[model samples]
Target: MTEAPHNDPAEQTLRELESRVEALVQFCDRLQEENRLLRQENEQLRSERAVLSERGEQARIKVESMISRLRSMEQAS
Candidate 1:
């Protein structure tokens, strides 16, 4: 009967190191995906902010126009 080869200390250490490296690679991949999603969310929020700012400006212009009309009417009366 043939016996299986026994693991030497050096070979065992090498195997452990290889496993750690693979785990690090997976962790890096997960971080990259998370970063990509965050960038997309940030861009969407910026677009929404711009739209809201434009709407606020339009509302301010309308209010100013109404106030001017009221002042003119009061002066005439």
Candidate 2:
């Protein structure tokens, strides 16, 4: 078979640079996906917090009403 062409120094450097650029592109894509997932999780947590706060308020009102009824009974007696 005919001899293969010898690789020159410039050609080798170009190949190495190209490989590094490809790795950087892949890393950027992974980071973007992670950021999107985190944003979604944050929104979900906010919604849950709002629901819990409303439920707490309802419980407080119910307890206060019961106490008022008990106080009236004690005064009547």
Candidate 3:
């Protein structure tokens, strides 16, 4: 088998490729952690939103009832 030429450019390219792979692995790990945190935050926000929605509905009903009652009183006057 013939031996390939020892090119400096090829060696540099190999080094650059190895570094890129290492960086990619690190980036994947960081993204995974960030995704986990975001999921937890989303769950918390959903719970809070549900509670707020219920409270808003209750407030809306109360206001509607009050408006209805005021209209009847004014009509009676």
State each model's C-alpha RMSD to the native: 2.9, 3.5, 3.9
TM-score of each candidate?
0.86, 0.81, 0.67
Please, what is the whole-model Cα lDDT of each candidate in the order they appear?
Answer: 0.95, 0.94, 0.96
CA lDDT, candidate 3, residue 45: 100
Q: Tens-digit lDDT track for model 3 on 41-61?
A: 999999999999999999999
Clash count of each predicted structure: 0, 0, 0
Query: Which ranges of candidate 3 are over 4 A from the true structure?
Result: 1-18
lDDT of 1: 0.95
Candidate 2, residue 1: how far the Cα is off, in Å: 22
Which prediction has the highest TM-score against the true structure? Answer: 1
Q: How far off is residue 6 in model 1, in Å?
A: 4.9
Collision pairs in model 2: none
User: Residue 9 of model 2: what lDDT?
Assistant: 75
Per-residue lDDT for 1-57 in model 1, tens only? 965455877778888999999999999999999999999999999999999999999
1 or 3, which is superior by TM-score? Answer: 1
Worst 10 residues of 3 by lDDT: 2-11
